[model samples]
Target: MANKKPLILVTNDDGITAPGIRALISVMKDIGNVVVVAPDSPQSAMGHAITINDTLYCDPVKMTEDADHKEYSCSGTPADCVKLATQEILHRKPDLCVSGVNHGSNSSINVIYSGTMSAAVEAGVEGIPAIGFSLLDYSLEADFEPCKKYIKAITEHVLDKGLPKGVVLNVNLPKLKEKEIKGIKVCRQAKAHWVEDFDKRKSPQGRDYYWLTGEFINEDKGEDTDEWALSNGYVSVVPVQFDLTAHHFIQDLNSWELND
Candidate 1:
């Protein structure tokens, strides 16, 4: 008997109409059966947050006149979309889940705040092999043509060789042309952070407000890091595990004299 088509779930932080997710959908269409459940509006930097205190909505949407595939516009975080997709939307658990092809970078320390990666992490928690993709460019018009081939390749590879439990891939592509991209590299997350500054101002209504601004700081000089790969024209693939346990420090922590 021939093998059944793999069921794939597609989602993003940039809403249902973003060109990035469209590119992702186009690529995924060739790979397997795809169903998209993404935010109705941009939800960048939402982390792994899920809606609790408010009503969540996920409704059918038409992305294009000729496009044929199940699509839903969700009123929740990226994580919430994944939860709803698996629990209520999809008829069955997806064989794979992919998020983003985001309009900006989710490399280095940015993954902790990325709704893109969070969706992938959420799928990982449900035992689904997942990947979050991003481009370094912040432009809405950024060319995603270069990313399609790699996306197809990586997705096929994952389907053929399933991922380890509790792990998901965080992939970031440089903003260079297809020819300029050296290759894909498996690397570590570079030690990096955002140094934020808030612009405090009074609104015309006499209320104080703040807008966040920051500069990215990359402190790690290691060549085997995502930051280095992206800087040198390579696609960076970081294996992210959702486990937050500090296992190495557990023994030392237990030795502390807390009982006294």
Candidate 2:
């Protein structure tokens, strides 16, 4: 008898042609019937943005023309791609949504600026279990072989166990050889920040422009954080939630005199 397969929606911020997404697709094919709806161009640091001012478009692309999976290239943000997949592309709701085998890390405070994480978060908001995976290396030619087995394992686990409602997994893998990778760790996003330094320069016309640059600073020394895991050569999975309300602070604020 044939095995029952899950239906997975695959997307990424690094455009459809990115090697990261290609590696991701290769793994998902083993677990499900995959449908990929990804941006036509890289849209890093888009941070949950949507294409409100412009109309969105998607065209089916033949990545491997003879392959069983269906893929599309979309002219929109990562969030827009997820919206299109959920509302317009798929015939039914997907069992899971996996975003990003990102070319760079989206761990710690970087999640706030990540198009990768935002796509997964969008799916979580629509009540789909989601995950975003990234490797610590940022090079376009970075080897993803080390992450393939772990990625497959994690995908299978989520499909089997299912995630908690409204919570999506943000997984970051270290850029180490497969043997060097210790193991997986369920962790929290570290309390960290980027110290921004904009490089100011002048064009030939003497107009000033700024190029964004930053260095990451981890304030937390906790071993139970994504940062610690990556630094220690382990795959980190942070169960991220979409709720931004500080429920613990509501009662403290209620005691304040507002009309005094």
CA error at residue 205 for candidate 1, angstroms = 3.0
- The residue ranges of model 2 lying beyond 4 angstroms of the native Cα positions read 1-3
lDDT of 2 by residue, 22-103 (tens): 9999899888899999999999999999998998889998988687878999999999999999998999999999998999
Clashing pairs in 1: none
lDDT of 2 at 219: 100
TM-score of each: 0.97, 0.97
On a 0 to 100 scale, what is the lDDT of residue 85 in model 2? 95
Per-residue CA lDDT of model 1 for 1-260, tens digit only, reads 02788899999999988999999999999989999999999999999899999999999988788878999999999999999999999999999999999999999999999999999999999999999999998899999999888888888989989999999999999998999999899999999999999999999999999999999999999999999999999999999999989899999988996797
- Model 1 earns a TM-score of 0.97
Report lDDT per candidate: 0.94, 0.94
